[model samples]
Target: MSLRIEQVGPASSARLAAIHATGFDRPWPANEIASLLHMPASLALAAYDGDEMGGFVLVRSAVDEAEILTIAVHPDLRRSGAGRALLDAMADVLVRTGVTRVFLEVSTANTAARALYDRAGFRQIGQRHGYYADGTDALVLEKTLQGSGQDGA
Candidate 1:
């Protein structure tokens, strides 16, 4: 599949919300995502296969830190790298903004998501009990960015 990541704009909110609802139980309302785009220090990206929206990621930046608000792949496209593509795109944005670390909270029951985060170099930091509206626990994960110097030329 030819997947491409594009920054999501207010006009895409309706489609973005539909993708989110299809992928997860707790989906953001269209207006919620639309509002995020107008916020300073926030970035939202949507992954697409041609004209079809496949996945998306929302993130917020603060100083040297960034936090992922949401990441979801369309149910039919899960395990097809759409999620990873969206994630990598967001990471690129964070790196460009000088973010030294990024964090996110995922449902404990989302093993697939956890595995993806693990492969992306995220380390589990802690857990929040009953963090979800459905009473699911959340696992907090963090990835520290390596300085350019640390990458070794």
Candidate 2:
């Protein structure tokens, strides 16, 4: 069960979309993922198990702040450390890029995702009512980077 995390470029959009579709009820299309990856301020990290994509995390950075666009793990691979590896890779990139804070939104009903974010040091910062298609409120979580010393100026 060797897992490797890699920074994914636009060429890997289809693979990212496939894994995302398997993990979520609604997934972004490959073209959309490619467009996001083409953005200079955005990045995507993928966790691969041998030849298969296990999970991914997409992020957009602006100055010292960054937002997690989305994160997902293959349904069959959840709780197998893929999610955590993707997140750890994401944080490593953020720190290296001088991002000092990161934000994400999770459905209040998605206890698994909330637990993952909580374990990654993110705390509830705000909320949005009826933020999801199913009317589930979204909990906004934020984590501030510590000791990186990069101002992101």
Against the true structure, whose lDDT is highest?
Answer: 2
Give me the displacement of residue 78 in model 1, in angstroms: 1.1
Q: Which stretches of candidate 2 lie over 4 Å from their true place?
A: 148-153
For candidate 1, the lDDT comes to 0.84
Model 1 residue 137 CA deviation in Å: 1.2
| Residue-level lDDT tens digits of model 2 in 1-153 | 899998889999998899889867788999999999999999998888898888899999999999999998988789998898788778878888888899999999999999988887888899999999999999999888855522222
RMSD of each: 2.6, 3.0
Which candidate has the top score in TM-score? Answer: 2
Clashing pairs in 2: none
lDDT of each: 0.84, 0.87
lDDT (C-alpha) at residue 124 in model 2 = 89
